[model samples]
Target: MSRDGSPPAATQGPASTGFIPGNKIFNRRDFVRERFGAAAWDAVLALLSQEDQAQVASVDPGAWYDVHLVERLISAACQQLKLDDGLLMEMGRFDADRELSTVYRWFLRLIRPSFAIRHMNLYWRRSHDTGTWRSWQNGPEVSAELRDWAVSNRAMCITLLGYLGRTLELFGGKLASLEHTECRSEGHATCIFRTHLELPADEPRPGRRPTRADISSLARELAHSPNREALVEALVTLLRFQFGCSWVEVWVTGQEDRMQLMGVSGERGPGDQRRFVLEVAGRAVGRLELELPRGPGQRGVDEVLAELMPWVSIALETARVDRSEPHHVEESELARRLRRAREIGQLTPRQLEVLELVARGKTNKEIAAVLGRSEGTVEVHVTNLLRKYGASNRAGLVAMFWGEL
Candidate 1:
């Protein structure tokens, strides 16, 4: 998708069966070979050839390739350089200049046009002479396996780091540091690449990390939020402050599979952002999105989100229940009893299927046949239902669940 949240069709070149037209002009492999020398390039190719015979047979540097192949080649290159993941990632953080940014953007579009890559300027300090400028390169389409490999290896992303480092060098900035704060492989919906400019020694340090007390207080506030709108607002505010994000928004599934914007915080940038689904009772109900900023303090946001989502779910469910009209106003006392009984029973989904069959006057053998479970398992479900609901037998369990229309 484009950075504006539109489909790739807007920027897409002429459609072709093999490769997107004009995309073959920029070959990342060729760029690497020219930059790093022939020996390093040959070593990377040897590793790629070992992994896939097809790669060896038909090595076309100018051709558009799948993301998986690119990732494999990068992994191999990392190995050949004899650089640990830390050094490799460190190599990615170079100074950013306009020419470097333009070249990087071209390479990104050529290789992964489907990704939403945007460059944003950061406000460092009031003094313009300090030149403590920072920029961010956000890639939402990063592969999960690559992210996982980075996290497990305690390494930075080689592809993005390499592009950023080279761009910085072209801009006359020495490589300082690069940090991958958020990663899809680390349970975030997007990969955030933060670039810190090589500031002078006299420059002040960046802001301090968000305190644990601040996060805990936000969690408490979310839990106590009176309604869904309030809950959403609290969440967006907390995330924006906690992460120093460019923007944050909540999108919930409304009627007809459409997404409804619930709340937003910070400057609304282009529509391109990362989306994380919010699930309840094994069903997707909403999504949380973020346009992350170029800064620090993203290390524990995932864990914080994990801790806070239950409250968000509860608030959403409460709002849904409030908006829904009562359908059981004319229900009989026996029907109400059955409903309460089921609520108190706490049956598993499989057990509930068995209960529905029992209510249909099905025996254990019949339920086993219908549900594809063994007769023994069906018997166990029935027994648990009876015991949980204080029923003496299968008929009593049925009486607790069955009622007139």
Candidate 2:
């Protein structure tokens, strides 16, 4: 049974299907017509293959073929491979301590034999996986399986590579090289091929040591830092440092709305503008913007957007919850006096002042000045008194208290 629990007709055994130079048979126009309906094959070939390249060479850039055909081809390949055997999954065990060379050999015998690889060689990260650099030394040898797979499914591999390339591009990387070669040893000979995706170097590690003292100091700094601006700035820096973008902006809208931009080093030309929406509890509360050259950055931007989504979601939720909570400020004589005026004289003095000011249409800042206090201080006083008497903002406070008074 396949993944969908259906019986295996498409998943026929390798031996049952005699390997006729797979590529040759599949390459025939009749095979395409029979396997995929003529119309579907034509559509896919038109968009994905070189079939239309000659005529379309003179076509306008804006009239380029729909790239989604590549996407659909890849999606179909992935779906088929999943229902059968995926090349990447077949190449090696994820957690096993496998030699890169052995893995490469296995890829040749298994995965490479199933694709129409003209030339390929695997190049890996310098040292992280094995603490040693490995070099490519062999050439590609065409096999019966490869020819068959290629003929039947060359579109799949091309689509897969494009999808993989686009995917890596999202992660600050690109598909860089592909090679095919032939190898011979002790009267044994075979074809070798491989593909490589190159990721840009990671950001330089921070110089500061994360010691106990450093952690304590950072904690103190965070405690003192203005949360919203600090958070926004940090998010921008993170996007740039992690994804290698030049400009990032976050727009937050709530009871109080704000926009913050970071990584704008100097005068800059325009870049691709992508909006990553941040949702909290399924409702969007904010968005992030990346302004950078588009070309290959689409993949990386998509990745960055995915990575930043949860962080932004958490931040927005925190902001929403925090907005409802009261602030902790040093009690002042004015606040005490106002509290007393309400209790002793059965009067809401703070309420009276806020209402009178509102009736006169005074702003929060103007009312704060009239009452000899900071705007924030005025806000808290108004908020506390309104809550105590079950009212809303200054306007609502005025409506209830003024009606009673």
Candidate 3:
């Protein structure tokens, strides 16, 4: 939870009772004040015991405080606020974001999740004095176990759950599965959490806005496109691949004020979504909508849309033809085939280039010439391609490329 990378003071005496950083208690109180106003936080204090009331008033952000009092304050606030218990995660997420403002939070976010899980206790220990947090990271799967952590209730556990999830978001990871498999609240001796995070190192992090260079590249690609559908496809593909949008759609407004779906990209997955109005010369031309893999937003949509204004403006104008339009643009058969082969075979970059050139009706020599590789290397790639495709020769490869026997 100390993601701000600012290590807490080591002034916590070795005490039997659990002690947490005073900043956390202060942050929670501040959250109540910011969320429900100052009077609401005062109401929360009135509900607490006299001992807790005094401690809450004089809590020092630099000192360690009793977690028991903090837990009670949380209970009273929740009861008075009538907040859904699930909002505890939201509160935790808010706490995580607040830490992002600290120096070195960026470094923490950039490290791999595996490293974070392995060394998470170093930071947790800075704030928590009574619990042993153990973690095991196996490839993409992470298992976290908390031992000797005795809390009055599960409220703190749920808040930590939200905190962990938000930290993963900052690390640019998408959770395929996250579950509190075991909890002290459930009569388990040690709390346990299981998680599977999808971190594709080759793929750009989700929630990042398109860069200026990315928009420039998209403009160049769109410039060479022959037709309206091709333009739409180019824009959709770039958004999906470049910035990790799960779904992208562009809708063009016609002369009569009717809207037409021009193009789409990526499978519609459950995630966060943003919608933007595309304008040209101050007139609304179309809408650019996209969904990112579900997580806290890393950047603003307006910044992303602004960077992509050049490509979006051109693509929108090109797609406004409104003639012989399909629901969406489809990739060429051969391009689709090449992409399918690349994915299915898990081809290397060179193999992908060879396969694409071959599908484009290039011979091994021509592929070598195009790729700046020797004919023998191209032949080796072609042979591997034949074996992967279950084809005997180059001729058979081409035939199978078109779904022919």
What TM-score against the true fold does each predicted structure earn?
0.27, 0.23, 0.46
* Each model's lDDT: 0.47, 0.39, 0.65
Candidate 3 C-alpha lDDT tens digits along 210-288: 5544455445445544456555654665566546676677776654656656554444557778887877767766787
Q: Cα deviation of 204 in candidate 1 (Å)?
A: 26
Candidate 2 structure, TM-score to reference: 0.23
Among all windows of ten consecutive residues in candidate 1, which has the lowest summed lDDT?
121-130
Q: Model 2, 158-267: lDDT tens per residue? A: 32233223322333345455433322211223323345645332122122212222333322322222244444544554444434455555665544334322112111
Off by over 4 Å in 1: 1-40, 49-53, 56-62, 86-156, 165-177, 198-405
In model 3, state the lDDT of residue 167: 78
Q: After superposition, how far is residue 343 of candidate 2 from its true place, in Å?
A: 47
Encode model 1's per-residue lDDT on 3-96: one tens digit a residue: 1222111111222222211121134444455557767767666765453436534655334444344444445555566545444443443312
Model 3 residue 106 CA deviation (Å) reads 1.4
**Runs in model 2 lying further than 4 Å from the true structure:** 1-226, 256-270, 295-297, 319-405
Give lDDT: candidate 1, residue 346.
68
lDDT of 1 at 158: 46
Q: How accurate is candidate 1 locally (lDDT)?
A: 0.47
Compared with the true structure, the alpha-carbon lDDT of candidate 2 equals 0.39
Model 1 lDDT, residue 71, Cα: 40
